[model samples]
Target: MSKIQHFAFLLVEEFSHLAFSCAVEPLRIANLVSGRTLYDWSFGSENGATATCSNGSVTLVHYGFDAIPKCQQLFALSGIHMRNHVSKPLLAALRRERARGTRIGALCSGAWVLAEAGFLKGMQAAIHWEYHDSFMEGFPEVNLVRSVFVADEKHMTASGGTATADLMLHLIERDHGYDLAVAVADQMVYNAVRNATAEQKVSLQSRNGMRNRHLARAIQMMHDHVSDPISPALIAEDIGISTRQLERLFGKYLNTSPKKYSMEMRLERARNLLIQTESSVTDVALSCGFDSPGHFSRVYKAAFNVTPMLQRGRID
Candidate 1:
């Protein structure tokens, strides 16, 4: 028989209850169907005892950071405000655990903690789409992918919500078999088992809730040419709108000016590239549409308040 895989889920404040349930339920059903405990799991928290999830539900944690159990895998589960919750002690504990050869993983914004703990250096990771911008600003060295999840060697990360279920199912398949993983999914009525290449969030059509073809094309142009971005005036011209009109449209709809939004979008892409790619800082700057590395550095430092070299060191 294969050895059981013990998983320790480290819960954080405002954790994603849905992701937690999605991760654990599959393991539970797997054992129930196979009539064996192929997966053993427990919960832990920094403070010990209980943690309130984003939905206002409370989960009782069985262990604290100081008393973490011997487990094959440790996944930190978190949701909103992950940056605010990361303390020096928590990062130190994670670093200590990692030094002991314990495999580390994260779900949702939990990647933020892993990044802060200096564990995601030169590692490909995934975070929820909503926080992708903030995460890039916070940890520029870690390679951030748009995929639903990334599993490399002993490390695993998922872009929370239902993606957590897919990640756990992948683990189950690795431990048990594909048939067992499928059975667990069937039991859970989970139709979508997103692969590693699958994106974390829905398409722009769903996100924008708009059917305007010109706006869609403009947005696509911006996304496609993130590194060499076109000017807002150019985008307006292509979409047959005056620059002033375009600014008004974006301000009315997106609550921001077109130029500012485009700059933000480019910076966001730059942040992701910095974390996910090994390109030189100059290369990263050029790729992100910044003609001068000095300018890029100034803006990047203003946004993240850290030099790119230091950020890279944190991830490496």
Candidate 2:
């Protein structure tokens, strides 16, 4: 019989409880269905005791970084504000474990930690979209993908949330077999097992309201033309509506003025470019449709409470 694959989860503060649960429950259910311990897992924290999750819940840890036991795989689990949590000791321990040949993976924003430890250089990684901008800025040498999960060579990374479940299911299939993995998914009532190519966030249509096709088209246009935004009047003309009618539609459905919404969209794109690309501030500003770098700086600072230089520096 094959030996059970030992797994250790390194949990950080504000870790996503949903992601952690999704990652572990599949293994537990797989073992139950297989009638043997195909997988063994434990949790570890920085302090060897307990760590609080983002949702105000706490999970007990079986060990600390210093006491991490031998394991076939180690997955770091973290969430919001991940950049602020990495310490010298944690980075050293992760590097040491990697040197020792323990296959390491990350869940959600845990990729941020891995990247900070300099483990993801030149490797494909996935992180939550909310942190995509900052992560890109911080890990310029790493290859970032928009997929829900990335499993390349030896490293595994997930964009977190339900993606964790899908990754765990993939692991189960690799270990037990496809049939068993399907059974586990059925037991959990997971209708669809998302593959790595799946997107992390919901589609714009589903997120914005199902019936508003005009709003959907408007949003799509905004996304497409972030670099050269169309005027609200032009957008209204293209969508075949009067400017007043468009304003009414936005007011009723989106609760924001069309101009404000367009600015926000441009600013969001600028933020992504500021962090993801090595483009100069002037280039980024012009790319995002801001006529002047000074104007872009003012708007960016107003939106994110930091200058573009400082934001980029933080990632560095």
Candidate 3:
């Protein structure tokens, strides 16, 4: 038998319990199915003994930041409020681990932590989609992708939730063999296992159950230009369709017009920015294409029944 490989997880405050389970269970199943000591794992936290997840559940740890044992790999796991929890000690621990030549990775918003430690400056990484906006704004040097996970990089990353399982299964296949990985996945009854190249979410076309290429192109254009939105006529013209046809497409499928849908998209981005970043209300409004904060506030209240300031305030 090959030597047993050890994995250590550094659980940050407010880590995702779902991601934690997905990351560790596959290894356990692999050992059970293989009937050998193929892998071993342990947990670490900022403090020595315990870490808490976002769902308010506590997890015991085998080590702390100051004394993470030697391991083949280490993964940092985090979730909401990830930025706030990135302390100096955690950064120091990650840097120390990397200096010791341990392969490092992240799960969920934990990429933000690794980025903070300067380990992912030019690495292609994945973080949960909800964090895409603020993460891009914060870590422009990191090549963030929309995939469920990125495994080929020196530092692997999973976008969190079940994507962590996809990554773990992939590692199992790499370390052992495809048959054992399949057996482990079967043991878990996870039929729709995705690869690293698979995107985290279904495409808009799939989500809305439509295959309209023109509609997809238009929506992509809108998403790509949320900060500096263009008119519906321009979108239609760019997509080689008439503005009337564009309006008709939206009306038939989304039950809204292009203008309304675009406005809603911008408002949604504005709301995310308010909750996820430290941008002022005026800054968030401008970032989402509004010129005047007062106009933005009125439209925001009309749409969500609360002002942008209040939205940010609610998070505290």
TM-score of each: 0.67, 0.66, 0.68
Which regions of candidate 2 are displaced past 4 Å? 203-316
- lDDT at residue 128 of model 2 (Cα atoms): 79
lDDT for each residue of candidate 3 in 130-240, tens digit (9 for 90 to 100): 777577778888888767898999999999999999999989888888788889888999866766655556567554424688988898999998989999999999999
- Identify the superior model by lDDT, candidate 1 or candidate 3: 3
Q: Scored by CA lDDT, what does every candidate get? A: 0.79, 0.81, 0.86
Model 3 TM: 0.68
For residue 303, what is the lDDT in candidate 3? 70
Q: List the residue pairs that clash in candidate 3.
A: none
Worst 10 residues of 3 by lDDT: 201-210
Instruction: Give the higher-lDDT candidate: 1 or 2.
Output: 2
Q: In terms of lDDT, which candidate is stronger, 2 or 3?
A: 3
Question: 48 in model 3: Cα distance from truth in Å?
Answer: 0.9
TM-score of 1: 0.67
Tens-place lDDT per residue, model 1, 122-197, is 7888988777656666777877776788875357899999999989888888777878888898898875575565
Number of the top candidate by lDDT? 3
